[model samples]
Target: MTTLAPASAKPTPSAPTAPTLEWVNKLVSFDTTSRNSNRPMIQAMADELAARGLSPVVLPNPEGTKANLFATIPARDGSVTGGIMLAGHTDVVPVDGQDWASEPFSPEIREGKLYGRGTTDMKAFSGAVLGVLPEFLSRPLLEPLHLAWTYDEEVGCHGAVALVRELDAWGIRPRLCFVGEPTSMRAVSAHKSSQLYRVTVSGLAAHSSMTPAGVNAIEYAARSIAFIRSLADDYRISGPFDESFVVPYTTANVGVVSGGAAVNTVAEKCEFEFEFRTIPCDDPKSFISRIEDQIAILRAEMQLENAAADICMTPLGAVPGLSPQGTRAALELAQALTGNDAEETVVYATEAGIFQRAGIDAVVCGPGSMEQGHTANEYIELTQIAACEEFLHNLAVHLSTTERNEQR
Candidate 1:
């Protein structure tokens, strides 16, 4: 009689046996949400780079709670200039309201998918880079291979903006930068720009029963938002369109709004956060000018009721778009490595735009999809990880054999 092993003794089909999954698990274990401190996670990655005989630089934020990481695997000739960069953001979006089948921070494998926050919205890409980094180090490289990871991308590209400034100061610029932002291993040469702002409307608070006695801040704010919607509708029906994007025209939305102390009182203050995502060719200033023009009209009307009434606008974040005209080298390289010849443009904004504006050629080519990102039970398919690994190894081989571009 054959002795049968129990079900519990059976091997887990979804266990993290793959090299890329191992790194993914290690990274996804940390909760580096946009609002939380990313120091611990950055330190762990820094330690890994040090262990491999690399001098990884960690630049901390003003509060020192968050950080950005930059490291390089120099070429055989010990040159650290004019090479390729593999980059990704460190922070994940908030999982506050989402109901997850698995714990967001504790990565789990099921059905050949690794489920966790940042798994698709880009820890997997970061993991893939780290997993293949040692291989790049072992090989004799013709040009340096650099790694860049930033904090607070989910909030905005603040970390990347600061990092690029620091890189500028150091005069450490890469010839091409591959920003890993979940394109399912395809290359995205261009992406839309993002501009977010906050508005605060102040008014006199009084009992709801007294109509017009107190300036209704919420009422005036509604008018401003209505104008913003009208602007969005105009864009939707207008001629200034780029058919390449999934959402061809520019988009405007009011994401967050908070006001009104109670149902029985007139709101004394109303605050709202709004954003505009424009195509690379679109002039964001025109959009802003129109919105401001409408807001000014409302502000004047609000003050008509009470001269003390006011509206204040502040810039929250700005991420410039990646224009296709400047990324010839990066496009050619990503195409060579992935064999993906499609002309791709993503509707989502990325740090690639920031890097591109900073005089570095950038392209988005990474594992997984945005469909799985920022949602409950977020997961990245095992196949995507394997393909990304293959791409990275191939990139290493190509870099090892190719000569550095002197034009950069």
Candidate 2:
């Protein structure tokens, strides 16, 4: 969780840069797991961008432990107003319990597969962007091109929330954005919304021998967990579904849990983390409203057992679903770039929706696959990287060829 802040003094600008493959390996070496601070990685990238004569802005969390980076490559006319923004989160999921074929943070390659914790999930996309920086710079762009590398995306897209605010503050609006989120080099036009939460329960503790003397927090927590499962089952049987999604309906899952001291002791507290991935047609507010009602009832039930007992649910973060309404141009551009005509959608969430919420058309298009992301021995086929590079190349060509006044 340790992070170093960006150096206060700016360095002299330089044009020398590394290749995309080297950038991918270097970025993967940084362990930016959700629980850790990504300030070091953000600062390093900022320095590189700044040295290349591009002004990159570093936006940090309230605590200043982590940060997001935004930079722009203007058109031949030196205008930074309307253009395309390429974004990717710098964070990777933890590799704690998974057994990797090679060191998780140390990048390795075997038989055309790059092995690393974030090789497939995100760093590859970000690395490929860095790799193609010069290509974007060399072209006579009609509109500006932007890079938005963010933090805490593995958690709840929190850093992107901040990035949106920062963009508004700077009065910068890109024509659209491409959120590179391991989509197998395809154009993804829609995805469900993702919301995360944590719940905690407290009760009076006593010896296990005298169950009547203690309010069992763990037992109370189980009641709420069961309630969550029941809601999931209810939606599974209901019809407010979007067939475009793989799950085709809303879903809830409790991913982590912990509590208690020992088997011989009555548990005084219990904590659990859960999330709701709601289809675009569903309302997450209604879902959270139901959860809050259940929390109030559970608190009352616990209080009846012991005056000191308590139960509470805290919202972690949320992102809205991406729909096709505003993505016409972005999808077309993606299709033109990748030469994929099929309309694709995913159940997983991405930062694309966050950008769309800011009135920017956004789509999910990137290298790698969800099958490889967040798994042991995570790797992206070298061919996927090649495809992404070609996609970027085509994008640069499109921007370079667009008329300055047309404003795509």
Off by over 4 Å in 1: 1-17, 402-408
Q: Would you give me the overall lDDT of model 2?
A: 0.86
lDDT of 2 by residue, 1-408 (tens): 211111113231221134878999889999999899898889889998998899998988999889999999987999988788999999999998998778999998888788999998998888888888888888888779999999888888999999999899989988889999999878899999999999999988999999899988899889989999999999999848888888899999999999998898899999999999898878899998998999999888888888889999988989889988863778877877787766799988999989998999999999999999999999998778877877787788778764323424
Q: Would you list the clashing residue pairs of candidate 2?
A: none
- Candidate 1 TM-score versus the reference: 0.93
- Candidate 1: tens digits of C-alpha lDDT, residues 189-277: 88999999998999989899996789888988888889899999999999379999999999999999999899899999998999999
Candidate 2 weakest ten by summed lDDT: 1-10
Full-model lDDT for every candidate: 0.87, 0.86
Strongest candidate by TM-score: 1
Alpha-carbon RMSD to native, per candidate: 8.0, 7.9
